[model samples]
Target chain A: MSTVLLEEEMTDTPAAPARLLSAGPAAPGQEAAWEQFTKIPLPTRTDERWRFANVKDLDLSPYLQPQPVDETTREELLARSRGLEKAAGRMVFANDQLLSREVLSESLTRLGVVWLPLEQALVEYPDLLQQYFMREEAILGGQKFAALHASQVRTGMLLFVPRGIEIDLPVEAFHWLHGANSSCFPHTLIIAEERAKVTVVDYYESADTNAPGLACAVNDLWLGAGAQVTYVCAQNWSREALAFQINATVVGRDAQARSLFAQLGGRHVRSESVSHLRGPGGRSDMLALTVADNAQEVDARTFQIHEAPNTSSDLLYKNSLDDAARTIFSGLIRVDPGAQMTDAYQKVRNLLLSDDAEANSAPGLEIEADNVRCTHGATSGQIEQEELFYLMSRGISKRAAQKLIVNGFLQEVIERLDQPEIGARLAEMVQAKFAAHR
Target chain B: MSSLKIQDLHVRIGEKEIIRGLTLEIPKGEVHAIMGPNGSGKSTLSKAIGGHPDYTITSGDVLLDGVSILGMEPDERARQGLFLAFQYPMEIPGVSNANFLRAALNSRQSEGEEIEAVDFYEHLYEEMDKLEMRREFTSRAVNEGFSGGEKKRNEILQMAMLKPKYAILDETDSGLDIDALKIVSAGVNAQRGPNIGCLVITHYQRLLDYIVPDVVHVMVDGRIVRNGPKELALELEEKGYDFIKDALAEPVSA
Candidate 1:
């Protein structure tokens, strides 16, 4: 497998044959959207949404859409795509191409569920795709990239849980960027109808940590009236790669939606997450954890919008920075005028491991509603000396003690997920990342 | 083989000397109690010997089993079989007591050696039973939100689990009630043997009633001025530290 991957690296030819945008049996309205993508200018630092970002890295000339891999590389990737022991369904994609799909149980299909690749779903359920695809605007920025994703994204998962159905196990999707200078745009759109319940996990990882690549990803979640949905996105890109992920969630009347974003490995990552409580008695929980080391920079932005009466939303983001790493967290909670009796909270905590590392937090709130309760806070601090002393007094070396404390800091966010297996796995992965740096 | 010897140890925080040339020796097969007044540097001596960074060892040496541990780090000193039961144990928010103890034990092993999970749990349960600690305490974060007595008991529990050669209990009886003091002392007494040496630093002799020491020393102005058998503690308890200070005022012959 290594020999085949090495052979592919030696070849200078483009991995995938660039299909001339010939009007070959185009999907009805997609062509116009594709045309719109070509017209939209790439984002620049001048744009308010792209402020404080390294816009020069937005150049897309060197990254080509990668082609499908040979059998050996494909088998190797499939072998490594394993995740949790019991997943409802699993799909593996390599270099923007589907490699394997496994529907573990027939019960899921019989329950009126639609879990398939985006292209297949588009062909079979175009109306459903049209009703939900890109429905929630990229309000937190990444509009141009969202447009590009809409134009070029061809492989991902589209999950639809019908009304009154609940899938107990989580659905898993894996996206791998294989070659150097490769770019993959992965999209996940999930809609849970009234009284429906489901959980979905998306894993973004690179084949090699030092390989340069670009990952432009987007996920949209819609919870119907009285539905409950939990989504988790674990991003572990290579050290030399650049990643951008935009997530938008809409919660309906009497519904609950919780989303966790775990940023484990990325050279330079910018994630924008937004939750909209659009119906009465709706609730949304937004949680994120990031461990940044070396020269990595993780920029995260979040928004909690209460648009209806008696709604609640909470957002928590925790980051641990070491060496010369950097992290920025900007979050806002906005309650509309009609969102009376609303409850909203936002908190950002940063644990700095090195004196030279930097963390910037900006928390804001704008409420036009009456009888509402809201609070927002941001804190950046080093590990308490007493806490370190406590650990060292127990025979743990200073380095190991620091690592444990940092892990404990991030574990608080992971623990809030209420899923033991997932929380333990994430903690282990974060600890492994810390150990590798040592 | 296990002993702690402090010779003319002068410790300071910045320019102010706290422990002014103190000297004491505790050997294995014995438990020694250091009784002092409130501001007499009993806690400072314990911390200084454990290599606390804030307390500077100005001009003396602390030897553990004939090896000077003045230059070692706190953790290295711990690995060398020295333990300091803190007066106020720190609250580590998210690290469970079980994992914390496991890490300490893991550090004693060579590189790449792993602790067997089943055996670790068995050992932990046995130690918890000895300390009368609940199994649930294993899941709780170390000293977080624990009551005063609970924290002291937790300190003793850790001392028992680590099985150190020389254990320094600094004010372990400070906030504990009488009942809790007995329980905590029982845990300490259970570990007393020829292989372990204990230095119990306290302000009152009340704790000595439970964990009866083999030797008792009166400390004043950061120095041990008198040393005797267990009866010395009872004498100090009745006469108080002032009487001991008056006696130490007399000049000593060479």
Candidate 2:
């Protein structure tokens, strides 16, 4: 591992040149786009959304393309990635290299379904990949990181479901970052055509807690007319790592989409998620849960856009902060002029476990449609004293009681996913993170 | 040697004295009843003895097995063999009863030692059966949406599992109908043994009828005015609390 770290350290010096050459495989039309990405500036302290955030901590200088590990380490990570024993298919990647892939049933694959790695998908389905790749720009101030991700990403999964087909079980993807200052770009693109239904889970984790790495990831979901899609992402990067993820979902007429983001790790992390209810009767649900402890900081921003009549969207984000950790949630819901009957709701709840911990929430709604129903709220509070007393009276220690209450508070958002297996696994992971902090 | 001793305990809440120099000793192998009207500080004494932070113990001490526990935290006090069955149990949303009870038991274990899951479940199921609780109740959130009777029974179920040396039942009979009272009392009676002491607090003497006490103490104005055998509860029930209050007034006036 030290040898690999040494090699990664040496490669970090020429990162910019390596990134430029990495973009050589892009199609002709993407050449100008890649150049445009190079011209974009990185986020700085002057940026409003980046204020209060430690911009100096956003150092990408020491990270390099992670080197592959031995078969023994790969096997160990593969065994650890075994979550949700009943998953439809499981794919494990170590150091941005695919270690194993469990193929789905033939019947499901025959229904015009495509479940393959991003590299393989790029070679086999170039046209399909081109249509959705980086189509929706990072409007939430992560453009530089998003561009850097597009230029360097090599390990990810693509799920393409043809018209009118529904996959009952969810597909799973795991991306593990190993070695010091290792960088990984995990990309997931899911396209469900007319009347199709599908679910996908993208899990991010690190090989060890001491490794300082970077994860710049993107997930794009395109739901066609009358389609339904559910996407869940659990980000459990190492505590010494930095992570940035941008997610965008486009919903067509009568289509429904639900997405959940679980952030249980990362020393400094920022996530931006946007949902575009583009056509009539489209609906989207955006849910997030974050557990920030120690000196970690988690910044999350979200947007819901009702572009057509009868569109609806609901967003809920919950955070539990301990020690000197901090969390910021900024969300907005917008209803267009012609989007009559638009229904949107946004809520952010923060549970503070320490006097020094901080939680900042900003919730906003703009409704141009006269008949729209929109509500947004943000609340920050410590665990109720009476509730703590109730648990303590039952013989639970103060520390254990606080953990239980926080878990219960966050379970509301997890339960909203309506997938029992995934909810349980996510809860376990969150509990594990809490235990580590203790 | 199992016993709970309260020595002239004076507790206050916001500068107002609730338990004024009240003392009581309950030894193992016996059941004691403290009957009083509302605002008589019966609940305050129980909470103070259990080491609740909100209830300030201005004077005196609480002891378990002759060991002082007044300086310990509530959970530490509990681990020292003291338990307080709350009058109004709180509703904890999204935390299953099984998990809550497991945490409580886990807290009692030595550091870095874990409870055996199979044995824990077996003990839990046995206690639930004695309390007449359904198996499905284990999965429900702790006391969330539980009826008054269910909450009291759940408290008894916890007492059974914890097997405390001394347990204080504060208003355990309040809001319970004849059927629920019988069920709850039966659960309590089943736990009564030579190893455990019980202090049952109630306004009415009806609860004593089922889990008949060995001694009956009449508490009024934050002090125990009279102490006697089991028949005393029957006498008090026949003649209401006013008889005791009027009787005590005459002596004070003289």
Candidate 3:
């Protein structure tokens, strides 16, 4: 029949990865999500959101849905998913399958803290997951990729804390890609009630350094009045992999939120981050660091929205490019009419190590509020001659001196996080990437 | 043989020649001083000896322990045990003093060898305390937001940590207050021993009061015009550099 011929042709040209949901039947919401995704047209050069992006990396026909991981490989990845020594809870996922989850302390559970995998949370707390999961449409490009992620996302964590609850230790998750041309979607949704505080860390990596893979990740953080949240994502996927990461944060009255992203790997990575200051006395600190080498391309977009009065947002992104690598950063700080006394600052710095490396930065500001202070700028430079000579005159070699200078260049952003342990861990990962460059 | 020997060294900055055929030596176990007025090419000599990129040694031979270091890079010469204590130490933002010093010491080690973190901190604290530097300085960015006196003391701290065989302190007393001068001079005096040869370049006799040199060389124009005992620094400070220009019977030009 004609349908058989169509099916054969569909097989001949691979479709997007099949979703492996554990539930008996597909959720009705995902079908709609998929339908919405299929209807959205792919990005083109003329599109403003996809400006300066490499559209060739968007071809998804070659990628297959992540297959089931073998027991041996799963165990190997579990052993390799090393992170902070002590965490409140930790989860390890390989090939989009949850391998292990360390439960929170009994006292935490008794305090009304809820931490569950996405699949389990969907069955137990459907209303809560439905309310927060992928709720904000992708506003800064990657809309199609985000919908694809929403439909296929099967693993990640959902953490909820009640009012006045504070978790001193951090919660962490590790997502590892295992196979070639395989695709995985990771989603993290955290909701904190009034006066609650929490910190979370995510590590995205690959099992092999040379395997080509695809990772589309989305994380959302919602803070109620007076709540605080600190999030750090250390993305060190394989050098041959393609990655897309989208992040959104909403801060309520008298609340504070800080998030940092370190881009250390992947051949071509697209990252979008948005911060919403929705109430008075709300503050958001968004920071990013990228060490792009070889032929890697890292395109990053950020948005800071001041939706309420007396709110503030600060953004700093630093990039160190070497060996023909390129990086793009486009950021905007928007102040709504009612958001008076809003203070917003955005800065992007690019440190080029090689002549062939390229850096493109576009910093924009839109202010509709009166009595507001907003400043935005971008700078690109190489190491200072005097700084280099000063270090080298003390017997530091050219390479080591360059390393010191680059570390200093990137340290300003890391220190702004104010998390010494997490910052140190991130610095180590950055050094590891630098060590690999011949 | 074990000395920092400069024989007929000529240095040029851009198209103009700064040092015109200067020769001097500071043997091990001695603290020799170079006293000159401003624009007498004293700083240029130090920079040339340290292989600063801007100062090219047109025709010179600077020997470290009888081996010529003309072909080595600045860092290589530094590893060869030649140290230059800059008068105006650079302020490197975001790089802590501790990390900078550690990187310097690590560069001196053989490949695949690194200093243990604990041991490094222990030794660093010891030296910093000797210099009367507060413990908080270890974590501060190198010389960033530091006072003039503090910058001079930091140079001394580096000198104490490196303990090089040959050292050229170019105008170390230029920016220091009286109290700072005493502390920094004492720190330098602590490293005065048989293994090091020092060249203390100064424009005033104030620093020499604390750090007494064994001998003094007076430079006029681009060459050393006279050599005397440590009292020459006092004499030069008393009579002023015009006496040297009068004695040279020529116009002093850099």
What are the fnat scores of the candidates, in the order listed? 0.65, 0.58, 0.76
User: RMSD to native for every prediction?
Assistant: 3.7, 4.1, 5.2
Candidate 3 clash pair list: none
B15-124: candidate 1 lDDT, tens digit per residue: 88998777788998789998899888899898889888899998988889999999899999999999999999998878889999999999888998968989999999
TM-score of 1: 0.95
Give the Cα error of residue B15 in candidate 2, in Å.
2.5
Q: lDDT of each model, Cα atoms only? A: 0.86, 0.86, 0.88
Q: Write the per-residue lDDT of candidate 3 for residues B1-254, one digit (tens) a residue.
A: 99999988899999988888888989999999999888889999998888888898989798999999989888999999989889888998888999999999998898989999999998889999989999999999999999988998899899888879999998999888899999999999999999999999998888899999999998877888888899989899899999888888533211
DockQ of each: 0.75, 0.64, 0.81
Q: What is the lDDT of residue B57 in candidate 1?
A: 91
Instruction: List where candidate 2 sits over 4 angstroms from the true fold.
Output: A1-33, A66-73, B234-239, B249-254
Tens-digit lDDT track of model 3 for A32-143: 7677677788789888877888887777666667765666776799899888877899988887778778865668888999888888888888999879888887899888
Pick by DockQ: which candidate is best?
3
The TM-score, computed over Cα atoms with residue i paired to residue i, of candidate 2 is 0.92
Off by over 4 Å in 3: A1-28, B249-254
lDDT of 2 at A126: 98
Per-residue lDDT of model 2, residues B1-254, tens digit only: 46788888789998999888787889998899998878989998987887777889889877799999988888888887788888998888888999999998888899988789999999999989888899998989889999999999999999998889899999999989999999999999998999999999999888999999999988988888888898999899899888999888511100
Q: Could you estimate the TM-score for every candidate?
A: 0.95, 0.92, 0.95
Taken in order, the candidates have interface RMSDs of 0.9, 1.1, 0.7
